[model samples]
Target: MKVGLIGFGKTGRAVASVLLESKKVNLQWVLRKSTTLEHRSVPEFLGVHSDEPGLIYSISEFSADELFEKHPVDVIIDFSSADGVDYYAEAATKRGITVISAISAYPDNKLKLLSEIAEKIPVLHSPNITLGINFLMIAAKILKNIAPYTDIEIIEEHFKSKPEVSGTAKKIAQALDLPDESIKTIRAGGIIGVHEIIFGFPYQVVRLRHESISREAFGNGIIFALENLVGKDNGLYTMEDLLLPYFHLNETEQMFIEKNTKPWWRFW
Candidate 1:
């Protein structure tokens, strides 16, 4: 399928490399305005469809209206910053193009805007997209019941170059009802990403961890989302809902867990 990449930064480059290797994706457009140096130095990459050369263009110079008129992209994966993400989302929705955003926004207000726009078109919004972490969500739900009444703490570590703490950790904390202040963030060299949540009672601590040794771990979830979009239409979806089938919890088991589980809101 034809796809568009909105950012050409490190994560975007990684995503492009994977998509190109899979050979299942046709990257139709790369929207970015590089400095004069980058424009001259950016090399031909794998993600750029071999048949479609020079798809990368500066957004600073290219208007959204011009993009819709000149090119048609089925899905747009936006790894751009919050500054232009909202505008791009609105423009993409108006054009009926499905959009996926890896960009994170603040104070909850931007998220509200994103959700509202997503409802108008097929939008996959996620702070983190690694399938391992999605599985962690399932495990967290399971632990919520079996380990209810236990003290919970989460630790997340990412590469030293990462500008912020792990978004995955924050999401887990939110899901598990752990106070925001209790989640610990660590930065270290060469670590792609790692998140461990521990449940502690009087005598034991149950730890559930998801670790990414490389950036390729993100491919599983990205492909899953893409496949889902191929079959479905417009709506906002998260990795949690995408990975639900793999959970395989029986009704009786679910009920039993529910009986002992603490609601996430109570964690604070």
Candidate 2:
């Protein structure tokens, strides 16, 4: 797969580092708002030994149309600001390129625009794209389904600079129909991110937690998304959509159950 990246900030740089090291995908180019590193090779800038032409471009120098024509890629992984979608939506749609937006938040209007573009190609939008976080969400939902009356609480922690509640935590809360008050926030040190969900039953407490030790986790999530998004029908998708198919028991497990377990009526 050939990949294009948007945004070269702290997290973006980390993701680029991971992509440059991967063998499965070729990183064609990266677009950033600043011109400080314009026209530079990403691999050289990051000190990685690769020959993939991982160049960097300033958004101001090249229009989206020109960039897409010059370096067409299989997919565009966006870790840019919420408005970054406006820059590539039309061009990407025209080329039928897959899009994976890891933007933290998007207003209603932009979300509607994403939906509109999804009509032409596969589009995935995720606030928190880390694989562990998405897996945590799926597990939390399953636990909720199993114990509907269990008392649940969501706790999110981030760096001290981030004051607002985490969008991911909110999504987890919404998934379990939890009220805002049920969420607890903690801001400290340089923590990348942490989300923990606690399920309180009559006899025991269950906790599911996902912690990001590094921003490279986002790149791993992008790789996972790319692997699954291929040949998908044109539509809007989330990480949950890509992961749900894997939650079922395998054939061997199912066969074992069938062979070993008797029907409830037989015991009665």
Candidate 3:
């Protein structure tokens, strides 16, 4: 499969690395202008064709029309900022290309509009795409059933470079019918991502946790989503859709919860 990566940053480079290393994927070329000598060397080592200067998109200034008219990529992976991702994603979907976005912290209007469009095309918009987190989402549902009397509180920690609280916390809060204010985010050094759900009562506290020691674990989930994008029906998909077997949700319940319980959407 020919894949185009937008926003060639750390995550984008990682996605390229994972895809190139995999047998089923082909790194067609990147879309952007300003390539350094170091960036130019990336494609050679990855064993894929690099499109630069001659029909290559290098600059970050991609207008929605330009993105729609010029690019013919099958799948576009967006790891760019939330600034203009909605436009890029909308344009990609209108053109029948599946767009998978991994960025977080965006306005609700964008997400609402994205969901509206997704009913027509396949679009993957996930704040945390790590499969482990998805597993947790499913587990949260189970805990809701098994631990009926427990009160849940979420806490998340991330690296110092991270700008905001954990999206996983926010996602978990939404899944369990908790409010946005009920979730907490922490920023610190040397920590990749950590989320803990504390289920408490009068006498005891049960903690369920998941931590990310490296970015590669997150990339594994991205690759998982990309792998499934092929021939998938049009719809808005979350990490819950990408992860399976770990959770005990049936098809009917999964669809109902995904459609209605998206608390992150409440931000809009």
Report the number of the highest-TM-score candidate: 2
User: How close is every model to the real structure, measured as TM-score?
Assistant: 0.82, 0.94, 0.76
C-alpha RMSD of each candidate structure in angstroms = 7.1, 3.0, 9.3
lDDT of 1 by residue, 1-268 (tens): 7777777777777776666555576766677767432332122654333554325678876678777668778888877787556557667878888877767544577777777777788778777888788788778878788868988888988878888766677788888877788788888898888899888889987888989877766655577778766656567787777778657788999999999999999999
* Model 3 lDDT tens row, 1-268: 6667766665666666666666665555565546543235455644555432113355554675675566556777777777546556567767888878787656887778778768878888888777888787788788788877888889998888888667668778888988988787788787878998888977987788999877667568777888877688999887777665444688998999998886876889
For model 2, how does the per-residue alpha-carbon lDDT over 1-268 read when each residue is reduced to its tens digit? 9999999998999999989899989999999999899999999998988889989999998889999999989999999898999999999999999999999889999999999999999999999888999999999988999899998999999999998999999989888888888999999999899999999999999999999999999989988998999999999999999999998889999999999999999997
Tell me the lDDT of model 3 at 75.
77
Question: What is the TM-score (0 to 1) of candidate 2?
Answer: 0.94
lDDT of 2 at 93: 96
Error of 2 at 6 (Å): 0.3
Give one clash count per candidate, in the order shown.
0, 0, 5
Candidate 3, position 167, lDDT: 66
Candidate 2, poorest ten consecutive residues by summed lDDT: 172-181
